[model samples]
Target: MGSAAADALLPLDASRFAAESCAVVDFLEVYYRDIESYPVWPDAEPGHLRTLLPDMPPEDGESVDVILEDVRRHIIPGLTHWQSPNFFAYYPMNASTAGFAGQMLSTGLNVLPFMWAASPAATELEGVVVDWMARLVGLPECFLFSGGGGGVLHGSTCEAVVCTLAAARDRALSNLGHEAILRLVVYASDQSHYTFQKGARIVGIPPSNFRVIPTLAGSAYGLTADSVHEAVKADVADGLVPLYLCTTVGTTGLGAVDPVRDLGEVARQYGMWLHIDAAYAGSALICPEFKDYIDGAELADSVSMNPHKWFLTNMNCCCLWVVSPALLTSALSSNPEYLNNVGGEGAAEVVNYKDWQIALSHPFRAMKLWLVLRRYGVAGMRAYIRRHVDMAKWFETMLEADERFEVVVPRRFSLVTFRLRPRHEGRDDMEALNRKLLVAINGSGRAFMTHFVVDNKFVIRMVVGAAMTEMRHVQDAWELVQDKAKEVQATP
Candidate 1:
C-alpha cells in the first residue's frame, strides 16, 4: 500500500512540474504587463480578500496546485497596485524590472551577511555601492570610507535616525556617567518628520527635552538657525545638555528643506551632533540643480536618505552615512567569544555591519540597489528625477492658474501642497468643505490622493513620482480632482 501511494504521488513527473511553473510565470507576466494600466483603487469592498481566504490553516501539507489556486483567487485582488501609473497619492514606491530581478536572485542565494566572514562578497558589494551612491549624490568625501567616514544601509529613515541618535547619545555620555546626564535635549523643526521625535523617545530623551522649533509661514518651512541657537541657549541655561539636532532636507508633510549650512553652524556652537534626514528628496541630488539644498552637509555628523522612495529601487533601502564610524561602533558594538573569527583580528580592518543599526540580520538588499544603479546610469537617474520635478512645476502652474485653488506652500521638490478656497466669502467652514472634497476624490477609485493639515488648514498633496507616470497621467489626475470637487460641490 505504501509503494502504491508513493507511485501515485510520483505520477506528476518533472515535465508536469515544469509545465505548472511555466503556467505560474505566464500568469505573472500577463498580470504585470497590464498592471500599469490598472485602476489605482479597486471597486471591491474591504472584506473581499478575507472572505476568499480560509479561516484556518490546513492540517495536512497541501499540494502546489492548492497553494497556487489560493494565490490566484485570494491574494491578487487585495494588492493596491502601487506600480500603476494612476497611483499619484503618496510618494511613489517605485520599482524596476532590473531591481526585481536582482532581488529575486538575491532571494535565491539566501546568504546571511551578518559578518564579513559570513558573506564577504555581500559585505564588500554593499560598501562599494554605498560609496558609489555617496559620490553620485555629491556627498563630501569625509562621509566615505576613503575619507575616514563610512556608510551602512538600514531599512528606513526611522532606523537611521535612531541609530545616529544612539551614537550621539553615547558620545555625549562618554565623559560623564550615563546617569549624570539628566536632561539631554534634541532639536528639530515643527516641520520635521514625526520619526525624529519617535527616535528621540526610543533613545531615552524625555519629551520635555525635545525642542520643536517653530517654522514661520511663507518662510520656506525649514528649521532656522536662529531658532536652534535660541533653543540650545535656553536648554543650556536650564542646565540641560544639548545632544542632537536633526535637520531635514525634505520634510514629509511638505517637501520643506531645512537650512543645512546654517543649522550646521548652530549645532557646532552647541556641541550637538547634526543629522540630515533627506528621505524623500535626496535622490534628486543626483541632479545638480537640487544639490545646493544640502550644501555644507559635510558638517553633518550623519545623514540618511531612502533610495526606495524615489530611486527606482524596491522597498526598504535606506542609505545612512556617518562622518565618524567610531561613534556608531562605540554605541552598538558587541563581541562574544563564540562569535569571534579570524577576520576581526586587526584594529583598522573589515566592518561588521551588525554594529551599525538595531538589527543583527539583514537581507541582501544591496543587490537591488546595485542593479538599479548599473542598469540606469547616473545620467538616466538624473533624467528621471528632472522629469518628475518638471511635472511638479507644471502642476504648480496649473494650481496657480485656478482662482479657486491656492497653493499653501511653495513648490519644493516634486510635492505640491494646495487647497480649494472657501465656497463663499468669510465662510468659516472651508476646511470642512475641503476635507469633504478630498474624501470624494479619493473615494472615486479612478485616482488616489492624500491630504496634509498644515497651520490648521486642510491641503491636498499631489506627489508625482510613480516610476512609469507620464505627462498625460498628471493631466488626467488633475482632471479627476477638478471633476471630483465639482461633484462634491454640486451635492446637497
Candidate 2:
C-alpha cells in the first residue's frame, strides 16, 4: 500500500523530470534572447503584480508548462529590467551572460562552501580569484594570504565596512579594553556614504564619536588630510581615542576621491586603522592611469571594492582585503562542536567563512566572479572600464559646451554630475528648476538617471557603465537631459 501511494504521488518517471528541467532551460534561453531590453519603469502600477499572482497556493502542483506561462505573463512584465542598456542611474549593476551562466552552474551544483573541506574547489577558487583581483587593483603583497594577509568576498561594501570596523574595534579594545575605549572616535568626510556611520553604530560606536570632516567647495569635494588631522587632534584633546579613519576613493554623491596618501600619513601618526571604501571607483584601478587615486592604499589596514558594480558581474560581490588577516579573524572567530572537523585539527588549519560576516548559508557566488575574470581577461576588463571613463569625459565635454549647464563636480571615473545654470538672472530659485527638470527627465521613462543633493543644491548624476552602453546611448542620454531641461525652463 505504501509503495502504491508513493507511485501515485511521484511523476511518471525520471525521464519526465529530465524533460521538465530541459524545458525550463529552453524557456530561459528564449526569454533572455528575445527580451534583452525593456523599459526601466513599467507603465503598470504597484498593485499590478499582486493582482496577477494567485492569492493562495494551488490545491495541487501545477505542470512546468503552466508555471512557465505564469512567469511570462506576470513576472516578465513587472521586472524593471536593470540589464537594459538605457539604464544609467546610480552605479552600473550590470551582468554578463558568462557571469549569469556561471551562476546557473553554481545553483545546479548547490554546494554549501562554508569551509575548505566542504567544497575544496569553491574555497580555493575564492582565494585565487581574490588574489587575482588584488593584483589587478595593485594592492600591496601584504594583503595576499601568501604575504601574511588575505581577502574575503562579502555581500556588499556595507558588510565589508562593518567587518573591518569590528576588527579595528577589537584591536583597539585589546590595547584599551572595551570599557576604556568608550570614547573611541572615527572619521570620514561629509561626502562619504552613510554606510560608514551605519557601520559605526552597529559596532557600538556612539554618534558623537563619528566625525564628519568638511570638504572645501572648490577642492573637487575631496576630504583634505588637514581637516582629518585637525579633527583627530581635537578629539584627542577632548580625551577621546581616535580609533579608525574611513576614507573614500570615490564618494557616492559625486565621485569625490579623498587624498589617500595624505590621509594615510594622518592615520599613521594617530595609530588609527585606515579603511578605504572604494566600492565604486576601485574597479578603475585596473587601468594604469587610475592607480594614482589609491597611491597610499598600501598603508591602509583594510580596503573594499565591489566587482559587481563596474565589472561585468552580477550584484552582491564585494572583495575586502586586510593587511592582517588575524585581526579580522580574531574579531569574528567562533568555535562550535558540530563545526569542528578533522581537517581543522590545528588552530591554524581551518577556514570557516561563517565567522567572517553576519551570515552562514551564503550562495556559491565566487564561481561567477572566477568565471567573469577568466572569460574577460584583465585586458578585456580594463578595456570595458576605459570605455566608460572616456564616455564620461565626453558627457563632461558636452555639458561644458552647452553654456546652459554647469558641471557641479569634477569628472572622475564614469560619473558626471551637472545641473542647469542659474536662469542667467542669477535667481536663487534655479535649484528648484533644476530639480523639476530632473523629475521630468526620469519621468519620461525613455532614459533613467539619479540626482544627489550637493551643497544644498540638487544635481543630476549621469553614471555611464551599463554593460551594453555605447557612444550612441551616451549621446541619447545627454540629448534627453538637454531636451528635458529646455522643456522645464520654458514653463514660466
Candidate 3:
C-alpha cells in the first residue's frame, strides 16, 4: 500500500452509496421491464466485448454514472436476456423480486458463513430454511435435520452430485480398499444430466466404470429399475461392485423422471447408494399432485434440486439433502487450527457448513431462499408453478390440434417437447428440417426456443417457467413456430 493506491479506493460514504444504489435500481428496473425488447439470444460474436473495451484496466476509480453508462453501452447488448418472457430455451432460472431483494441484502451484509462459529445466524437460518423446503416438497423425514439427515445449499446441481459421489466413493473405498476404486461402478440413465458422469470423473471414478443405461421411448425416456438391474447384473458378472446409482426426478433434456422407488430398491439390493437429481421438476413437489413422482425418495441416500430453476429463486442456489449428513461431513470436512471455534460447549449442536461442501467459504445463499419462501408462502409458490404448467398444457393442446406438428413427448412440468411432422412422404431428414425451423424461429428475435433429440428425432422444447412468462407469450411463441414451420416447409 501506497497512499495513491489506497486513495483510488471508493470512500465508505453512506450518502454516496445510497445515491449510487438508487441509480443502479433504476437501471435494473428499466432493464427488467423492457427485457423482451432485447433478443433472447444476443447477435454478438465471440470476443465481442473484448473488442469494445479498453485493453487495460483503468488506473483510476470511475464515477458510478460513467460505469453504468458503459454497462448500458457495452454489456447489455451482449447479454442473452434470460429474464425475457419470450425466452423459452433451457429450463428457467427465475429471478423473482423477493429473491433479488434477499440477494441484495446478503450482498450488503457480505457475510461468509462457512461454519456456525463464523456466523451462527447464517448457518442456523440455512438449516431451518432447507428443512422448511423439505417439508413443503414432501421429502422423506429422514432427509430433514431433525431426523438426523440434513441439507446444504450448493452453487449448482453439479457440485451436489460431486459431493455426494465423493462421499459414496469414500465409504465404498473404505470397505473395498483404495485400489478397488477401479472396480467400483456408478450408474445413471442416458437421459440423466451429464453431471453424474462428470461428477464420477471428478471424484476419481474410472471412466470405464461409469455406466450409462439407455432409456427407451416406450417409457417416455424414464429410467426403469429393470434396465438398472440388468446393467448392475452385467457389471457384477464381470467382478465389478455397484457403488452408486443416480435416478433423476426431472431430467434436463426431456423432463423425464426416473422411478425413484423402483430404482432405490435395486440400489439397496446391490448395496449401492441412490442419489436423486431433481434440479428442475422438484419445485412442482410443493403441490400434492406431483408428490407421487418422487414416491420412492425415502430409499435415496441423497437428493438435490434447484430452486433457481423454478421456485423463483435467482441463479446459483441448489438445495441438497442427504439421509446421513455424517457421510458428507466425514468425506468433505477439513480441520484447521486457524478456523476452529473458541469453545467446545456447543460443538455437538453447531453445524459447520464448511464440512458439508468442497469450499470452505460460501455466500449467505440462504437469505434469498428464505425470502422467496416467506414472500410467496407454499400456496403462492404452488400457484406460480401451476400457472406455468397450465400454459404448457395449453401449448401442447394447440400443437395437437394442428396437423403440421406432433407433440414429441407428454408434457412434464412446464416443458413441452414438440416437432413439425414430416412434410413429404419418405423423407428421411426430418431432423434437419426441424433444426432449420428452430434456427429460423430463434433468428427472428420475436421469440426463442431450444431443441432436444429423442430417439434420433429432433424435437423443439418450449419451456414456459420464466418468472414473467404468461399465456400471451406462449400464444405468440406458438404462432411464431407455426409461421416459421410454414416458411421452412415451403422452402427447398
| Model 3 ranges off by over 4 Å | 1-5
* Structure candidate 2, residue pairs in collision: none
1 versus 3: better lDDT goes to = 3
Per-candidate TM-scores read 0.93, 0.93, 0.98
User: Ten-residue segment with the worst summed lDDT in candidate 2?
Assistant: 32-41
Q: lDDT tens digits, residues 1-492, model 3? A: 457877766665788888999999999999998888888888889898998999998876677889999999999998888889998999998999999999998888889879887888998899999999999888989999999899999999999999999999999989989999999999988898898999999999999999989999899899999999999999999999999999998788899989989999999999999998999999999998899999989999998999999999988899999999998999999988898668532667688889899999988999999999999898899999999999999999999999988888898788999988778867737888899999999999888889988788888999999899989999999889989999999888
How close to the true structure is residue 174 of candidate 2, measured as C-alpha lDDT?
A: 93
Candidate 3's displacement at residue 130, Å, is 0.5
Given candidate 2, what's the lDDT at residue 60? 62
Task: Name the runs in model 2 displaced over 4 angstroms.
Answer: 1-37, 347-350
Better of 1 and 2 by lDDT: 2
Q: Point to the candidate with the largest lDDT.
A: 3
Q: What does the lDDT come to for candidate 3? A: 0.91
- Candidate ordering by TM-score (highest first): 3, 2, 1
In candidate 1, the residue pairs with backbone N, CA or C atoms under 3 Å apart (3 or more residues apart, or in different chains) clash, namely none
> On residues 232-285, what C-alpha lDDT tens digit does candidate 1 reach at each position?
888889889999999998888888999899999988988999999999899998
lDDT of each: 0.84, 0.85, 0.91
Q: Which digits, one per residue and each the tens of the lDDT, describe model 2 over residues 1-492?
A: 356665677654668867987898899778656543556656678688888777998766678999999988888778766666777788888788778877777777788777766776787777788889999999989988788888888989999999999999999999898796578998999899999999999999998889998787877889998899888888899999999998898899899998899999999999999999999899999999999999988889999999899988887799999998888878887777777767744646445676677666656788989889889999999999999999999999999999889999879899999988765576548778888887887677767788898788788898998887889888988888889888887877
